[model samples]
Target: MTTALFPPAPVSTWLVPLDDTADGVVASLGLARPEGAPASWLDADERARAARLHDATDRHRWLVSHVALRLLLGAALEVHPSAVSVVREACPRCGGPHGRPALGPSAGRPLRFSLSRSGGHALIALRRGLDVGVDLETATAGTPSPAAPATDGLARWVRTEALLKSTGEGLTRDPDAVALRPTAPGVWSEHVEGDDAAGPELVGPAPTVADLALPSPLVAAVAGPGLDRARVRVHLPATAAA
Candidate 1:
C-alpha cells in the first residue's frame, strides 16, 4: 500500500508464542519476581486475579499476555516495564469496570491497542489515536470452545470480533448482527447495522478492517479507522525474550 493513496500512522504488530512449560515463562519474558511470589511485572490486582485462576496453563497464558503487553508498551515509552500504567474504563453501557483497557497519561499521545490470544499464540496490536482491535485464533482439529467461533465461520467471525472489540462492546453485541464485505486486499467495508437485526443498533463508526496474512492454522484480523492505510509490521518467531 502506498502512503499517498492511504495516509496511515505507524503501527506495530507482535506475535508471541505461549510457552508450554509454565515454570520458565517468567524468565523467558525477562521479568523478575520475589522468591515464591508472582512475577513483579504484574500489579497487585493482576496478581490477585492470576492467583484466582486454578488452571496452571490458563494462569501462565494470562501472565504472559499481560507481561508481554507491559514490556511492549514500556519499550515504546522507553521506561521500565512495570512503570507502564494501564487501566480498564467502565463499560459505556452498564458503567462497570470491564470495558476496554486504556493506557495511562504516562503513555502519551492517544496510544490505543488490543490484545487477543488463542491456543498457543498471542497477538498485540498498537496504533496511535485511532482505536484498534486484533484477534488471533487457531482452527486446528479440536473441540471448539464457546469463546471461539467455529472455524467454518472465521472470516466473518474474526472481522466482526475485531470491529466489536474496537468499539469496546465486545461479545455483548450479538455476533450475528455484525457483517463486513471485502472491498480489496486487506480492505473490508463494514456494515455496523445489518440484516440480522430490525432496530437501529448503533455500532459507532466503521473502521478500516482486514484479514491479517498469518501462517497456517492461525486466523487473525485488525480493525481501526485508517488502519487499512496503516503500515503493519509483523514480527515473528515470537519466542524472543524482549
Candidate 2:
C-alpha cells in the first residue's frame, strides 16, 4: 500500500494518469462497464444519462477513469470495493450547475470525493468530513499551454467557478453572485448568496487552488473545509496496483 505521508486526519488527493498503454485503458474500462453489477447501484437519472453515453468514446473514457479513481480511493480508505458505489448524476462540465457525483447509501462514511479529467490524466480528491472537489487538465499540444501565465484575476475567477461547480450550484446563473477572496498563499474563499431571490447563503472558507507539476498542460483546484493540507499523489498505470 502507498503510505500517506500526511497526518491521517487530513484530506488525501490522488492524481492518476491514463496512459495510452493497454493496461491503462483496461483499468479505466473495468470501471465503465456495468457488467453483472446491479442496475440499482447507480442513480436512476444517472443510469439514463450513462446509457446515452455508452457508445461515446470521450464519455466512456471519462466514466471509466472516474470509476477507477473511486475504487482506488475506496481502497485507500480500507472500504471494500463492493461497499463503494457511485450515484449517476448529471454533472455538467462547463457553465451550467455546480455539482459533484454523489455516493450511494453504502458510502455514508465521512469521506467525500470528487473527480475531474482533461487531456489524458484523471484526478481524484478524497477527504474526511469535508465536501471536496478536484479538477485536472493534462498538458497536450491541443490543450491550453501551462507556460502561459495565469492572471491573478483569471485565477480567482476560475477558482471560484470551480468551487461553485463543486457545490452543485448552477454556474450559468450569475458569475457576479459569488466573490473570491485571497486568504493566504494559494488559498481563497468563496462568498456566495442567492441572486435576486431568497436563495441559500453559502460561505465557504479557505478554498485552495494549486498548479500541479504534471508534464502536461494541467490545472487542478479543490474547494472544501479543512482543505489546506490537500496534497496530490501521482500514479502511473504500471505502479498503481502496487
Candidate 3:
C-alpha cells in the first residue's frame, strides 16, 4: 500500500540520538557561545541543585538533556547558545497548569518549542505562534505492579500533564481536574479547559501520537494547535554509534 505524503508546515521536529556528546550537539547546531558568558553548566544555584539530585547519572542526564535542548533551539532559531535560556520550574500535579521557563531576549518572538527525553533518545518540536508540548516514554517489559495504575489511566494522566506543560502550566493545581483519552497504544490526548485564565481555551483535535519503531520500547506524543497538519521530522544525532 502506498503511504500518503504529509504536506509541509512551519512546525518542525528534530529527534537527536543519545550518542551525541554535549559539545557535538552544540557544534551540529552551528551555535556558538555568546561572549562573556560562563562556559560551565552550573547556574547561580548549581550547588543547591546538585545536592537535590542524589543519583550522579540522573544529574548528568539532566544537565546533558538541557544542554541538548538549548543547542537544538539555537540551531532552529540561528541564535547564539548564550542567547537561549532554559529554566526549571514546577508544574501542577493534577491539571493543565505549567510554569514558564526563563527565556532570553528573544522570548517576545513568535517561536514556540517543546522537548522530551527518554532512555537513549531525545525529541524536540518547534513551531511558531502555537502552544506545543512533546513527551517520551520508554517501554518496559514485565507486568506493572498491582499498585500501579492501568495503562489507560497512566496515559490519560500523562496526556493531561503534557498539555499543561505545553501551555506553561505546571502542577500548580489539582491533577484530577483534567481529563485524558487514549487514542492508541503509546498514544494519548486530552482536552483541557478553565486552566489558563488569560490564555486561549485548549480545544479541538489533539496532535497525532505514535510510537517509534525502535529496539527499545518508547512511546511519544505531541500536542499543539494545527499539529494534525504540521510536518514532523526526527533527527538522530550523528555522534550516535549504530
List the global CA lDDT of all models. Answer: 0.70, 0.53, 0.53
lDDT of 3 by residue, 3-29 (tens): 111123555555655555666655444
Structural similarity to truth (TM-score) of each candidate? 0.80, 0.63, 0.65
What ordering of candidates by lDDT runs from best to worst? 1, 3, 2
lDDT measured at residue 201 in model 3 versus the true structure, 0 to 100: 43
Error of 1 at 145 (Å): 5.5
Q: Tens digits of per-residue lDDT for model 2 on 163-198?
A: 755565535446566666666666676544555542
Candidate 2 residue-wise lDDT at 137: 46
Candidate 1 ranges beyond 4 A from true positions:
1-9, 20-38, 142-145, 192-205, 238-242
Per candidate, the number of residue pairs that clash is: 0, 8, 18
TM-score: the better of candidates 1 and 3: 1
Candidate number with greatest TM-score? 1
State which candidate, 2 or 3, has the greater lDDT.
3
Give candidate 3 misplaced runs (Cα > 4 Å): 1-8, 17-20, 26-52, 87-98, 105-108, 143-148, 151-158, 173-177, 181-215, 239-242
